[model samples]
Target: MTRDANRPLRICMISYRSNPHCGGQGVYVRNLARALTDLGHHVEVVAGPPDPLLDSAAKLTMLDCLDLYNAENPFRTPTVRELKNPINLLEWLSISTMGYPEPETFGYRAYSHLKNRVHEFDIIHDNQSLSYGLWALSRLVPTVATIHHPITRDRQIAVRSVRSFWKKVKHLRWYSFIGMQKRVVRRLPKFITVSEFSKTDIHAEFDVPAERFHVVPNGINTELFYPLPHIEREPNRLIVTNSADQPLKGLYYLLQAVHAISKQREIRLTVIGTPKEGGGIEKLVKKLDLGHIIDFTGRVSNEEFREHYAKASIAVVPSVYEGFGLPVGEAMASGIPVISTTGGALPEVAGDAAMMVPPENPEALAEAICELLDNPEKAKELGEAGYKRVQEQFTWKNAAEQTVAAYREAIRDHRKI
Candidate 1:
């Protein structure tokens, strides 16, 4: 049956795991689902463990998973009853052997659940789960997989970050799922990504032609991340959103800059994430005597996020690579001046609204931070520009419309076959 272009489409948005508190994938799922539903399209979110918070207008279908990798209890063994299902058994075996199996296993689960109900929805939208089951689904119904960016970059950076031979081997083994993703993505025809940089990078890494990819930029939720006019911005106070110990986040460089600046003047740095106890970040803080200057707010609510941004003089995105650079957009939407690294798609998101610095360079970061702090007028100017940029360029309504176009294209492609 062909889709009616004038009528509202029924969409099955599938995500293997979605935790609404953090991570770009979960954030993407929540906002995009709401946006599509707001456009009068029927959106039903089918997700796994650690539920995603969605708008009341959107329906949610929860899927069961062992959730062995939950941060609270990492790698917990499942009971015999839980493992009775072959799919669960496979997931356990894969993780026990140091391989990430969520994509492949979740694909099987999604396929099992949706096989008989294929006609219930007009299309299936897979959020970066390029599993073999997604390929199977495309054969039955139109499928659009959003490859945020190639996971190959993560694997490469992770493998190189470690020193020991055994550590490098472990990283490689853990990311073995990339092999399946690469094969699965190459077979699929329709794709959606967040940026031009991601589209080109995915094409080179996944070997999917650029023409097959649709670039639909993610929208910043202004209601959740707008400037708090009542709160007074602090001076010589800096804030950054990052996972403290992740090598790809470039937090080490930001800390180095903070330490250097603290020696010359009194400055406070608030990190919107926690560091592992006895981790490298904790040790560095002790060695540099920066414990007094730096503060880490583990996980924060939306209100806390705005409060943090409202109190800060500047917001920094020190990531080495980001497919869409949500932090940059969020900071901009909050009406804060941003200093971002020239990594992956950061420049595409910042777009002259932010001060661009070279990635992994502490000196450049330090200079830029000092420049913004020293000139409040300049910082204010940038902040206004960024807010205007977000209003004019980024919105969930726009993203939802572009995504529908991509869905129609996928349907057309599937019908031709």
Candidate 2:
């Protein structure tokens, strides 16, 4: 497919799991597709498993795969109908017995379906499904994959933190997909990442040249995330958005900080994602007698999420690492003062607009939260500055423009080959 400077480009975005509630990948797929469509391009998102909440402007093609690990029921037995397909049954058996991530296997299913209609799109953009199938598809189309960040970091952190030696072994076994991802990522023609921090990490981890990577910042939907005029902000209330049960999110640290803060001052915590009813976080909440002070609103809709941001006096992002902390940008866009840890690309995204602390330091987190809570004027000033920062720096329009340029560059480079 040749890029014509005057004509609109047809683009297909592929993702293995695009559940908005799952994590950043779904959010990225939805917002980027909308932004590309807004730019007068034809955008089709082909995804698997959980449904993606996409913009109406973009066309959505559902490519269902055996979603063996849905969050609602992490590991449930497939029905007879789901097991009727021999490939699906084999994939399920492999995952059940060996503990390997299935996104690549599923991506193969999606690729096979899309490859038959390869001529339908000018470019194929993948959302972190760095599978062998993607390499196969790249030969037939101008393909570019977005590697959010190196999954190796996630595996290392998870393994090192496991309390039991057996559990650590299991962690390594589960994350064995990293081997496949590393090979797939290195062989890709071009890569798009959300931040320079991630780009550097990707190059180091996958041994890809710096020239093969493009840094395109992810966007926040300011329209949906903006502050609510009617909602009253709560005093001394703190909010953090994460898959709270996930250790990599650093929710445990935030919980420790909240416990420390509650001892000195009256504070309330509202967690956006759900925690296991009898999990570590729930145990901590009980141990600290934080039932009255802490509340978890599990898997809220977009409007409700915005209301939580609006009601909170401040937002805290306690991630151990992020490719680009979407919550930080989302909080900033919602006109909320942010207190983030200096983990990964957070400082790059927050800049001077947010108060930064070191990750896993409950004391530092408590101090920062206290400082903001004690001084309303400072908090309000920080909130306004953050809003302006997001407005100027991280918008979907900017991301799409940079991405389109990268696509054009990839096409030019491919032609020379």
Cα shift from native, residue 329, model 2 (Å): 0.7
lDDT of 2 by residue, 1-417 (tens): 434764788898899888776589998888888888989999998888788978659888887656667766867888889988766886787688666756667678777788898899888898988888888898888889999999888987888777999988888888888888888887889989999999998889889999999999998888778978699999999998874666678988888898888888899999897788788778877887878988888889888999999999999999998989999999999999999999989999999999999987899999999999989999989999999999999999999999998887777676777
Candidate 2 lDDT score relative to the true structure: 0.86
lDDT of each: 0.90, 0.86
TM-score of each: 0.97, 0.95
Model 1 regions lying over 4 Å from their true place: 1-3
Candidate 1 residues 94-180, lDDT tens each? 899888899899898898889888898889999988988888988899999998888898888878887999989988998898999
Q: How good is model 1 by TM-score?
A: 0.97
Worst 10 residues of 2 by lDDT: 1-10
Residue 272 lDDT in candidate 2: 90
